[model samples]
Target chain A: METGTVTTANPLNVKAKKESKSKEIARKLLRSWTGVIGFSLIILLLILSIFGEVIAPFDPMDAQLRDRLLPPLTDGHLLGTDQLGRDILSRVIVGARVSVVIGLSTVLLAGLIGTIVGVIAGYYRGWIDIVLMRIVDVQLSFPFILLVLVISAVLGAGLTNIVISLALAGWVIFARVIRSEVLALREKEFITAAIATGVPKLQILVRHILPNIFTPIIILGSLQIGTYIIAEASVSFLGFGVQPPTAAWGNMLDEGKDYIFNSWWLITFPGIAIILTALGVNLFGDWLRDTLDPELKGE
Target chain B: MSDILLEIKDLGIQFNTGKGPIQPIRGVSFSLKSGETLGVVGESGSGKSVTSLAVMGLLPEKKSKIVSGSIHFNDEDITKLSEKQYRKLRGNEMSMIFQEPMTSLNPVFTIGELLSEPLKQHKKMSKKERKEAIINVLKQVGIPRAEQIINEYPHQLSGGMRQRVMISLALLCEPKLLICDEPTTALDVTIQAQILELMKEIKAEKNMSLLFITHDLGVVAEMCDRVVVMYAGEIVEVAEINELFDQPLHPYTQGLIHSRPTNNSRKSALYSIKGQVPRPEEIGIGCTFANRCPHAFEKCLKETPPIFEKGDHLSKCWLQDSKRQAVMK
Candidate 1:
């Protein structure tokens, strides 16, 4: 713009720019203590899920009647023992695998399905839009958890059923969110530019516009991980979740309810585990959403 | 005489709506010979752009349609081409630069990406070749730090840089016909001149025919060799640039010239036309501008004057006959 000193245009020198943008996103992510703390908790749980078997002092399925209902500060049971005589510490640690796997895979499947459905509906529009939206409408009419309950019951209850059920329950959020995003994005001049350049519609979606909306998806996905965990726990507690011997916190709670009055440690510890894991994921998601907002991008 | 590169004859476009359909341009005709510039000047709703867009096949079909038209480019009816074929023609044979450069360039993409897209699309150049072409286009457009700006997003650059980027993108393919729909309107005055200069340079370098659409008569004076002054979706006057400015035929043309402020002049309250542009619903049966014309007579009110040409100039008014009668006397 300042005339005279016009330098040569080099398109390939974009690596520095892309690197800086990524750094900016990372810097923004780390700006808050809450974001860092939430991130650490999620990471810690993920690590435990990955290596819980290697680290658990006693096998997650092992029980000792002699050690049953041991309170905190007892030897052998790190936190305490549940009414089932299973080590509560070991079970809570092992529950991370089910919760993380279900939460992540549900969101992954839902986000993939919903984003495709939404993009196709929004991009092509007209009859496709009407049909897809009508489907969305039909899906929306049912209470989500009830729908999940029916689905899991039909599929016969297991960890996989909970994953499929949670995926069915949550896919609508992505369909709605991404449909609107696509609607807005499709009309921009860049789209026309892309069209002029003969960029395929699918490429435009996956490459150009998808990157722009990923932050919101990540934020929402992270937040929903917590909700999915809680949902999985609820399903398990209702006798519709993991089929025992897995040491999922929800089933632990189901077994612990009998000892709730005399031996509160049984229900208390698993309940706390569920609460902490959900709280951790939700906090991280919220922080991610806040920081990723374009308005808050700079200093 | 130059060869006819883009020939458009009797082009009519309209918009379909709940109220049936509205005819924006009844029938418009124009042509762009190779290496020629045609300045289409008019008030906002004069169908100047609608006509160009119809020729380019870029109409937003939601509320618009080309009910009837034949656009001949390189001795072929472009209107008959499929959307895919039309796209093939757009960036390769004919590229368009839109008025708002900011909106025209994608904010998410780097200028380099935008500049190199057409090169890769039509030219099929490898990355290194495309990179060099992008930088060359940017340098030609007079963007300093073309390399730096190439990596920069649209938001990172100033308005002028964005406009230059738009220009670079347009010229990247070196199309034969550049349909610039008021490309300089959103720029600053100094930047406007710079863009105009850059456009002229590009036009000459590529030997491309340019269809420069604008409402500013001043720009017509500076950039056009021939001019078409439109009023209410009709071509009221067309002539060589010098003759059109010197002996303006249409009352609309006269009004536009008088409306421009001049240096060291009384300005005479800067004459403006008495009425607003006729809404499509309010248009009368005869001459669309009859109600607003100062020299309108009974005949002018009842009849639409056909275009009468003398040499390369044409005037659509009853005054030509009267002037001829006076000359005979």
Candidate 2:
């Protein structure tokens, strides 16, 4: 419905118009200081996750009772040691591996599953829409942590099991978001045109519908990554997520809670990691939403 | 032109709204011969587009139902065909182009990809062959610099160019019939003219039948060989293009032609039709256009009229009845 009068009048200017429009969005995103900081922090966390073990000064699990509860800047421990004398800095850095991996994998799994269901339900409405949406509603209504707790309890504790639990919780969000988008797009003339062309239903879903809805999926996935990471940490803290020795941020916070009045550094460092990662990913997601769809940009 | 390409026999389409069922197209029958262009003209909600969608098998499954109909396309009864069977015929044997060129081509896809889809689906062409064929078709449809424009997306083209791409895409498989539903309704007048010219040329070169649906009588005059004037979903009159324009039958058709603003009528108020098309729910047993018709009588309000054949032309009105004929005689 957007009538680009200038572009339509002079056909030759269309390509240039698109180029400048994208460049303008890119420039605006780059100029936002929060976006830059968020982008940098996310990159830093990714590097740490990939190279954490190589960069850590000491083994994360190595505990020496003799050096237990060491304060900050004691005996070359940059961030000091926990109640078990394991390096706090080493543990947090290595813990990034679990958080980032779980966050990204859960998002990927949820996005794929959700998009397929959403496209099917949205494109072929009536009974399919009713059934799929009702299931989504049921999933959404139940408490997030409650469902995760129950699933993790049944599945037992492990990284993959944790991923599956979170993914199951996560897919509903994507399905709901994408289904609404598909509903609007179904009435668009291009979809009818595609159907008229004799393009198979599956082919139309893949070729026509999926690409158009990819922007929203990417934006939602990026934002959900932060939420899922925090959720993964929460699960791990409850002993239903990653087992203790794996060093997840949630359990690190849990371990530090017992020694909180005494050793503040244990919780302080891991808590910062969650806050910083969440902050960065959230800002970047906001920027992505603005950049992909200009209509969403407040200005 | 003698060969019958498509036939619609007593096509009855009904929609089940929350309130009740409304039969939009009631026992409508028409046919298109090979290489002949048939124009269906009507106002908004006249079921012109719905009829076309019915032919394409693109009607919404849950909302709209073809209650009773048979669509025979090249000897195959498409109404009885399954979705899979329709798929094989679509884009290969018959294709359709819609109004709003900007919205009709997927915005995400480059013109190259959009154009090459039919080839990939129906034709077993390799990548290189497909590219070549796409470029060839684009050029045929009058897209300048087909090589460069092929890589550009729909948002990067003008309305006219996008329409050209649509035409080229529809023509890729050399379909025997092309149904264009108000293909020029969304473009500017000049662009509409260009698109019509392109369609006219392509249609001639391919020797294909065209079912053009539009409300613009001028377009019908320019492009169609025969015109079907419809009111409230029923065909009121059917005649050769020149004959219809010269001696316009059906009060609705006359109203449409007179409403067109001409250069000579700049000082005077543009003529307008009186009442809006009655809603489907309000339409009853009597003639749908009786309230709007300039010459309605006691009988026109009481009973619906059957289509009366007079030589090559057909008109559905009490005036075309046997009693009226007897009185006149």
Candidate 3:
């Protein structure tokens, strides 16, 4: 007995149903306080990063000698001017672009490299697994900061170099996490079915293995963004990232530290910005893990 | 013989583990004729699945090797086929449906995507042609709402529907030989009946040879033309379906037939063949089933029995020997 109604049903109906299901998930996510606050903060940071140039009240690089070290509640400067008499509010907003860019870029680069390495190692196994895993082990054994510093020093200090160095240091975690995920996933019956179906090894890795491990990768990426942001700040503080006049959060923090005692606005404002952004990314990451993880859903 | 689609002669598979090398399949031999359903019946650890995997060229490469024997498909010895050559044959000339339907289909893919994969890999067809072919096969397997079901993921369907999808997948390339390894074991009774019925219809319509592997004798009686009884990695008997049930020659085969619970025997305790199937490492020089056979004697314990043929029925037990039968009497 063939069904008459479903045969004539529009294919667009499936798309509509999928859209509604995602909308329902979004509504459920916003029901929790963590989701609401984390989402709002993430939105705020994204806005600040995108619209920093237009939104800043004064040019971040413009110096106002008379307005130097203006404290909170000042007329011209919102958060206050830094020791260089540059608008702290303007610089912080502009700094969002650098922090977000470096954090996002580092995560993307590292995740791409790590996921590829991990999938290859986990899928082929044998000597490839042993060799790749040994390399990961060697990298992980070194102090993370020292490795980054060495990489940064070799590449020379700049925005791109910092992202590169951070990604090099950061990828080990992803490689480790995804390799284990891929290892477990390779044993799944669908993979065997795919092999039995004559699917090429590369296609199976891309189509079957990659999609299944995406949730973990996304969760790991979001969490790592906070760490990368802090790392950029640390590297910049050491004079190895985002040179002066660009107003990156890390370099801004480096400049503000000298005036930490007297001009509290300098260090305080930048410090608060860094903390808030890191907090936002971390909170969003946690909520994402809870929402995206199939095991944790509906409970 | 000319119509034999696939034949395995003395196939042996050895898995090298850290403990030592263990031979899971030793001297497994059978032939599946064109348009015939050959059932390989065995309990778990009987090397049924391993033998099927070896046929598909899906065995774990680094750990296991084909220690002895040859698998000939359409006159070609597939055991020696390179990986690339096997890839061309797999899903093109032959395909397999696995035991666990729940885990066999990728969860992330839609039914349409899953079905389209084999066509894309082996067949040269335009997108529209592929879709039409997919819907045709899906409907042939008795899946309703073909268009609607295509867009749904594996998790959206029940176990029966997924198994149907898997069957449809295996049939997509129209492979000459279809190996069903316990395809209906995971389903309940009603669903199992429906799947088996569907498979029979498909096999008839396509004239595809089927290597049906299952431990369920009931399934073999319903599905098979001929049956191969494997015990502890060795074939104890091979017979036509009706003859094997009518006059099982080997003691092990007799025990298996008697062990089935019948309508009249339901009230009594079910007859069971005593002792577990021996682990691969535990097997020695004697007949593997000698310890469990009711008629096992000095010869059965000290030496292995060669396959004894009486007409078309073959049994691997000392009891099959005329001299041994006379001595026992």
Interface RMSD of 2: 6.6
B48-166, model 2: which lDDT tens digit per residue?
Answer: 98899899888888788889979889877898888998888888889998888988999887787788788887999877788889889999988888877876778779999988889
Ten-residue region with minimum lDDT total, candidate 3 chain A: A1-10
* lDDT (10s digit) by residue, model 1, range B225-283: 89888888778888999998899988888888878878866756776888887866666
When superposed on Cα atoms, how far off is each prediction in RMSD?
4.2, 4.4, 2.8
Candidate whose TM-score is highest: 3
lDDT of each structure?
0.80, 0.88, 0.90
A-chain TM-score per prediction? 0.88, 0.89, 0.93
What root-mean-square deviation over C-alphas does model 1 reach?
4.2
Q: How does the DockQ of candidate 2 come out?
A: 0.46
Q: Is candidate 1 or candidate 3 better by TM-score?
A: 3
Off by over 4 Å in 3: A1-8, A296-299
lDDT of 1 by residue, A232-261 (tens): 888888889897888898888898888789
Give the DockQ-based CAPRI class for model 3. Answer: medium
Residue B103 displacement in candidate 1 (angstroms): 2.5
Question: Which clashing pairs does model 1 show?
Answer: A6-B144, A7-B144, A7-B145, A8-B147, A9-B146, A9-B147, A10-B147
In candidate 3, residue A125 scores what lDDT? 90
Q: Which stretches of candidate 2 lie over 4 Å from their true place?
A: A1-28, A294-299, B325-329
Top lDDT: which candidate number?
Answer: 3
